[model samples]
Target: MGRLTDKVAVITGSGSGIGRQIALTYAREGAKIVVADFNEEGMDQTVSQLKEMGAEAI
Candidate 1:
């Protein structure tokens, strides 16, 4: 099991750059991810990537 299993993480500026990377890592660690960012496109991309990793994210 991952360290963050069953945890929920809200990441600001997760649309891109370091924020996006952090979101991905948290998701991989089994945390449910809530991505918040002004850039809709970037946020969508991050969510998509998380999904592909079999991680729950929004």
Candidate 2:
């Protein structure tokens, strides 16, 4: 099992770049991931990706 399984996480500036990658990586490990960004469109895309990864961002 992943170390982050069932854990919750909040990531900022995750709409793009490193932050986004971090969020995705964490989610893949079974963590609840939150992607926050000033870019609305970027945010949407990231959120969508996270959802596909079986994670959710609030």
Candidate 3:
């Protein structure tokens, strides 16, 4: 399992840019992600991408 397995990361501004990258990285490490951003559409997209990668995100 990854080092972050069973961890949960709450990432702000994760709808795009650096925040999104960080969320992706954490997800890769097996963390569940809670994406927070003012951009609802962007957040949805980020969640979709994470789910596609087999990551648990909301």
Candidate 4:
């Protein structure tokens, strides 16, 4: 298991740019992600990508 397994990460501005990248990285490290951003569409896209990686996100 990853070091972040069972951890939950709340990431702001995750709809795009560095925030989004951080979210993805955390998910890869086995953390569940809480995505927050002003851009709804970009947030959804990030969530989708996380799910595709088999990571839990919302």
In candidate 2, position 46 carries an lDDT of 92
For model 4, the run of ten residues with the poorest summed lDDT: 1-10
Give a tens-digit lDDT track for model 2, residues 1-58. Answer: 7789979989999999999999999988888887789999998999999997778666
lDDT per model vs. reference: 0.96, 0.87, 0.99, 0.98
Enumerate residue pairs that collide in model 4. Answer: none
Per-model TM-score, in order, reads 0.97, 0.89, 0.98, 0.98
Better candidate by TM-score, 1 or 4: 4
Residue-level error in angstroms, candidate 4, position 40? 0.2
Candidate 1 ranges beyond 4 A from true positions: none
What local lDDT score does residue 6 receive in model 1, on the 0 to 100 scale? 99
Q: For model 3, give the 10-residue run with minimal summed lDDT.
A: 1-10
lDDT per residue (tens digit) for residues 1-58 in model 4: 8889999999999999999999999999999999999999999999999999999999
Clashes of each: 0, 0, 0, 0
Candidate 3 runs further than 4 Å off: none
